[model samples]
Target: MIDTATAPGSGGAPPAAPTRAGRRPATTSGPLRREYIWLALLLVGTGAAYLWNLTASGWANSFYAAAVQSGAKSWKAFFFGSSDWANAITVDKTPASLWPMELSARLFGFGSWTMLLPQVLLGVASVALLWAVVRRHFGANAGLLAGLALAVTPVAALMFRYNNPDALLVFLMIAAVWTMLRALDDGRWRWLVLCGLLVGFGFLAKQLQAGLVLPALALTYLFAGPPKLGKRIAQLFAAGAAMVAGAGWWVLVAQLWPASDRPYFGGSTNNSIIELTLGYNGLDRLGLGSGSGKPGGGGAPGGDPGGGVTAGVDLAAGGDMPQMHGGFHPFGGQAGITRLFNETVGGQIAWLIPAALILLVAAIILRGRAPRTDGKRAALLLLGGWGLVTGLVFSFMGGIFHEYYTVALAPALAGTIGAAGAVVWAERERRWVRAVLVLSVALTALTAFVLLSRTPDFVPWLRWLIVGVAVLAAAGLVLRGGRRLTIATLLAAVFVGLAAPTAYAVETLRQPHTGGIVKAGPATDSGFPGFPGGNRDAQSDPESGAAAPGGDAPGGATDAGGDADRERAGGGGPMGDEKPGDEVLALLEQDGSAYTWVAATISSNNAASYQLAADYPVMAIGGFGGGDPAPTLAQFQRDVTEGKIHYFIAGENHGPGGSSTSEGSKITAWVKDHYTATEVDGVTLYDLTATPKAG
Candidate 1:
């Protein structure tokens, strides 16, 4: 392969360097023009894929959607992560990721489109930004491939189209990557500062998850940056400081403020943002503590000896993934070495893992230990290290790992695949490069077939067709081929790598997902658990009264009578079953109150639905799980006596004999015993205003 920098010329000299002002010397503009066209297509295609039928799910996770809506209403709620503008308590995670959604809702008047539009735009922008970053170092083709690979990855499509923090997390991380690369190229301190700011802002999006790329990025710069060793260290230190300023300002402010002045941090035991960061969102995720780890049944960390709240057990964790039946855990079920490649998770994000691995290995061998300063070596380190390290973390992290969390792995995977493609394409004349490309496509196709086989209910023919095309594309590369045939072979390889995932993504779009965690795909049948789109007839389970895991009703609630009702109420809405029902709203309106809270409910989702529906503040009594003791029994009594709270919606709890037993059980029991139960819309409501004072 000819190096453009050293191509034959009168002196066989390297190309002239760019001026100090950073303008490049003029060259033939054809490649640049072609790149622009490819970029345009990539953006347009990504937008179309993400935006198509986007609102079909209608506020993907009511949990976050409610938070976004609340944020739009109150600046305090926006910053504190409250799901309601009551500003009583924060959501489990921080509010950094919700900022854009809040702004969108505020500007667009709060609807499904407003909730999700930012995610769509962010996803598209990330693709464009990734292209720019890759093209700067590896030329146009590699950039185009990287952008396309990221844009089409099924999980990427699913996450970007949904109202999840991951969309913004990914975008900010990409921006950080792009800026970091720029800093390396320009050897400028300002770029490093900007990189830090981006990463810090990313931290706001997802706490520690956003920082996973930091070590690799910082180390890469220290080794390969153009500055002297002393200067690089100093600059990296400055960048680290900038990162802390950007990401930690909120934590600092939240901590310094009097507890009475701000909402309680939802996920933390003592309402401390720092604890939330270091524990639930930090160390516990690494399986070192009690924070929510991967999908399995891991124990929560015990409390601090000083009487801080201890982490609780999460049953939903490894028992059986929600909504999945037939042992096909689309989201990982257990934390282990092979989690990512297993049948449960592979199809969603691992469509090209085999191909990327093969290409990475081949490229590493072909590059033959190039010097640190070599562009190829740096590119390999940046992309390959990011992919491998992240994949391993996601595979082994022992806490609350969700299927969508794997979207973090998408960009790195795409980058490595693109970098490998570029190296192989550059060496197309070599038999070994061609052979590696063939091996990559074959592995990708075979792996994709295996993943698709795990869900035979989805169209199986698509897998066979993808495999056949991939095989043919591999053959085309080995056969005597013209330039057009070579291009065809490349296209075939791209198609095979993308086709199966694309089909799965299409099915995901066709279906609807709700709840705190969701996956992309149609229900296999009416019996499929957690699937809101299952056939109505197949969903009924007479014994449990609740539909099975995958068999959730379209409204997101189960019809099961007792425990299921509690789950539905506790889980919050998009349950489709929840309706403000003119009756419920009218009843509340008729009974005016001096209290800021119009009513109280167990779960944040329940309160969120009522608040959004009624445009009133309803207390989410026990936080998200109905397990957090947000407001104590004593507090509720004081609020009642002082006229700070009115109605209390009773009967949502997890206890023996379907009785009330959760964090706020004392409150629930107190309300039940004092205020007479009035059934409205099949929910037991209590008129707190009617209760007699305790002597």
Candidate 2:
């Protein structure tokens, strides 16, 4: 057990004298110097990796980027996370994740660097916090290793450098765990309350996904908290109250504000935040209900098809939806036990998962007889439960899954490996423990081989190198001799376990990713068969301006280029990557201040492109997938009659799979009936202010 092996002075050394606080005195200068040096190196390395070439993504997910832009322009938009300064409709989720970027953009002036820099800082802080948490129980070496593991996770590296909610969500989750563990150590009410507050803020970042850690937190405290039964129950109630307060204030404001004055609660059919939480962001995410409130209206893959306009296409001919770049499977490759290991997802966060699971079991069995309040066992329970619960939900959940969502698993896996590895190493003198260590390394190496084989052409030799090193390390562990030999063998094992993921992380950093859905590592056959390259842009017909069916386009176009060129060269369609042409931008900017909105579009993705370029509010008829009824046709007609909206840009109106006679389709039909179309460079626009022609 860890208690017997790692006890102070248990390894034939004199016990350190206790200070007035009943804690051991500080270690000698030599050991202290090395620990601080390693800590410094870990933090510096993480910051450098996350910050390298941060601007290459250039408004990464322009959907969020456009919202950040709106928030920077108007305080109302900032508070509501509206898609435009005019506050026609808010983005699909809560505004907490956008708050930091909005504040930064307001202070530094909005640009790619200003928008993304906050995310990078958050990623680095997560690494440092993970190290501190592990070091509090395990040794310094274990802490450094955990930090390194998290930093090199491919998905972690990708999301940290991009402007997405996952970065803030992950940071808040880790901080909550840290505080929960501190409470376990002392049975303090304040720490538990702080932990609740952190989780509540996490809810504001990504909704229900933040609550995945709640079970582990509550169970850990109940079993391992220093307080007696009655006090522990009382404290949990207090923590629950704090959590409600932390997350409820915003919900109250959004619900209590006069419906006519504030932005509509986006992603909700009834314009209610409560519905948005329990329906769209909650049950719909779990595949329990249609996210858009209509029957079968969720954004599931290959669902019902709806009609919409595309560049160079007529309103009657339902245009082809934009395809995912590289033919990557968007649902994380079907719901089941092996989902995480699928080609589309395995390369991101699955590299260390096998080892983490093995070590978690070993740590649990070794600590089985420890006392009820043992901190080491408590930490393992917290981390292991977190990884298991979150991983299973990710694997089997049938709705709206992305490969990058695996980033949530990074911190828990890293902490488990660090804590368990320390325990197994302390008992290395036992032959069975050494054998378990060898088996864990072999399994990890085998996993690396399979994942590496999927991307054979990318670092082809690395997989074989890992297998060879793993074998050598196993033999060295079985027949150890000197201390130097043991150290060398341990180094080989580390290389075998970390080399593959680290390579993938480095590759992720090299490429510039821009899209609503992104993956880590080089392109491989892991994507759907027949989609084998990294290019994400759909090919468009030069003369007709319509995207070619099943054609590929250039990927990673910068915002500095001509807007029309960027649209043609990138995956700009319903995917939200499209930018306005020079002619359209000029047209929209002319006398734009006279109207509340320069233009309106059916989907947020389509509207985000023009809104970002025009620097004006362009009402998204429906939120996100064009399903929620933010503005009914009557509302839109009222705006047009009052000369509030200038133009109506014709663009895609359906969600991913497609919608079924949703409000977006209705608005599009009415717009076409009432106005004449004007083509500018390839985009279709209708001037809403002009008198309607005879039907």
Candidate 3:
């Protein structure tokens, strides 16, 4: 967050002086020990707040779900942190954005849960970046305020705890921008190289989202600067190299892989690697999903379809969204080129989540507007744009829209929100306004804790008291200043107050088996992410609980143009109540070799029966006709003569992602005679797997 006045124009124009500083230097000197101290306090406070969410509740986000599914398919990939997540297991075309965790896993073998740590780790990094950016642009107080704001933001809180690419994306993007600014300012070639490398790697973490944030920020600065031409070009080129290093490896590999190996959807054609790669990650300015908007997440500019129905209706009738003209997107041009920002960044999130963001944004606009010359202002523009761009592009994903998608834009937004908190300090005169500032930060912190306190073990009353202390601590900051005694007391009070709630959260996570989520990769193909402390009791609640067996997906069933019945899904898992320890229930939650049967099977694995029947919703592949694979050649002939096995599945197992693996010629014969293929995912369904037997 460099102030423009101190930062030389990328276009070579000098920035305007601040109204408050009559003789502010073009370049400001620096802070002493206090700088690190306040930032450290900020870090400790934020860490305490988010640590509570470590095991608060729910499942791993879709990105991690895709990763964990991939992990299960190939242990080698899982162990080596493989990049082979090309739609073999999960539904998404490519989870290329999961490079960092894969790389970490390949290097470390702590299991899937380690992946979740990356989000928190990156969140910590984002706070650090905020501190650094704010320190450079504003002062320690402003930096501290920025850190405090980010710590409590609902979105920031979610991204920090949830397993997704956004948190990591935010960290890397900020790191890249911060480094790039440094590189350009001092003409340090090494920093530029670091910038390039960071950009490239961040690009890998969340596709082009991170890579573009830096350039976008730079170019935005250029908007403020008249044209310097040559210098701007050189700075961009140096930064470009950083992006290439981190993300370029994937491009080369995607090119070399055979076309058949890469059955990507979206706008990617298996032409050459470059075309596939670009369309996969770069194009679509507004596309959603890993490969989709990396084609069309952009919607019509200023198009606010009030709620999803209005958006869907507009897409259907307004000629505004893609219409099915000849079964294709009719609005397939530039309007379609960039996905709507309103949808991606502004649209998604819990209704309250958006409400909170609106509140923060409004607060900044009305009460907390920082000096225009402040570098924090520049940082805000950059981070704000980053969140807006990713949020807008990813929200329109036709298929999966997990909570982590919000992570992509979170870093920029978090730090900016924190800066907004500091804007409260800008009001030097009004005592009441400053009191409001203290109250706002405290309220924000309290709200975040309440929303995050969904875990069963945590006592709601205790959490409220912890929040009360944090509010008091925040109030202390205004009345005190740089006095060694007040600052130290204030710092300790603020941190401990925040830590109490957070500490309770972490302790609650220690108990395993509580209903929770894991990042298991695509079904059967691969899988896993996260630690194993859970308290999941996947049983029917006596009090208006879901079905005794697992119910349908909470976010709704993901039907990527396939046969899936939500009614059948609610009953997936054990037919009888889930026992104290149920592996099938666990497996059911993950993406794995899932096959559904309406009737029964020869296998005596009771858990399997309940698991398959209750957790997964696809129709059965056996016993519908004469028998799966047709009972025997003679039986098959009799059944065929009798017209049995109306539907069935055959062919090789194709490893994980292949067609149905159920075998035996008699099995195949019986299946065909008695059953008909119903609908399939990687599994085959039969209209009949068993004969009527004249019953």
Q: Which of the numbered candidates is closest to the native, going by highest lDDT?
A: 2
Candidate 1, position 393, lDDT? 88
* lDDT of each residue in 267-351, candidate 1, tens digit only: 5666777877887678765646643321121112111101111123122221211221122222355567778867546766898
- Flag regions of model 2 displaced more than 4 Å: 1-25, 291-296, 300-330, 525-575, 653-660
lDDT of each: 0.67, 0.74, 0.39
Ranking by TM-score: 2, 1, 3
Worst 10 residues of 1 by lDDT: 301-310
Q: What lDDT score is found at residue 415 in candidate 2?
A: 89
Better of 1 and 2 by lDDT: 2
**Selected candidate, larger lDDT, 1 vs 3:** 1
Positional deviation of residue 343's Cα in model 1 after best superposition, in angstroms: 2.6
Tens-digit per-residue lDDT, 1-695, candidate 3: 33322221111122234333222345322334545666788788766656653532223332243344345445533432221232221212234445455555555642334545555676777878876665554455555655665555444565566554566667777787677445433444566678778777775555555654764556644432222557656756765766676677755665555644442222232233344335433443334323222112211110111011112332211112232212222121112223322222221222122322443454445433554333444555555566656545554433222332454554555455444434433442256544554555565455435433543243546556656666565656566554563445345444532343244333323211111121110111111111011112212112111121123322222122111211122122211111212333343344433222222221111122232233322222111111122122454345435533232333211100111222222354454455554433333344443443441
- C-alpha TM-scores of all predictions: 0.86, 0.88, 0.52
**What residue runs in model 3 are displaced by over 4 Å at the alpha carbon?**
1-34, 48-59, 62-66, 69-100, 103-112, 187-193, 211-215, 221-228, 241-245, 259-377, 380-404, 417-567, 570-695
Name the better of 2 and 3 by TM-score.
2
Among these predictions, the greatest TM-score belongs to 2
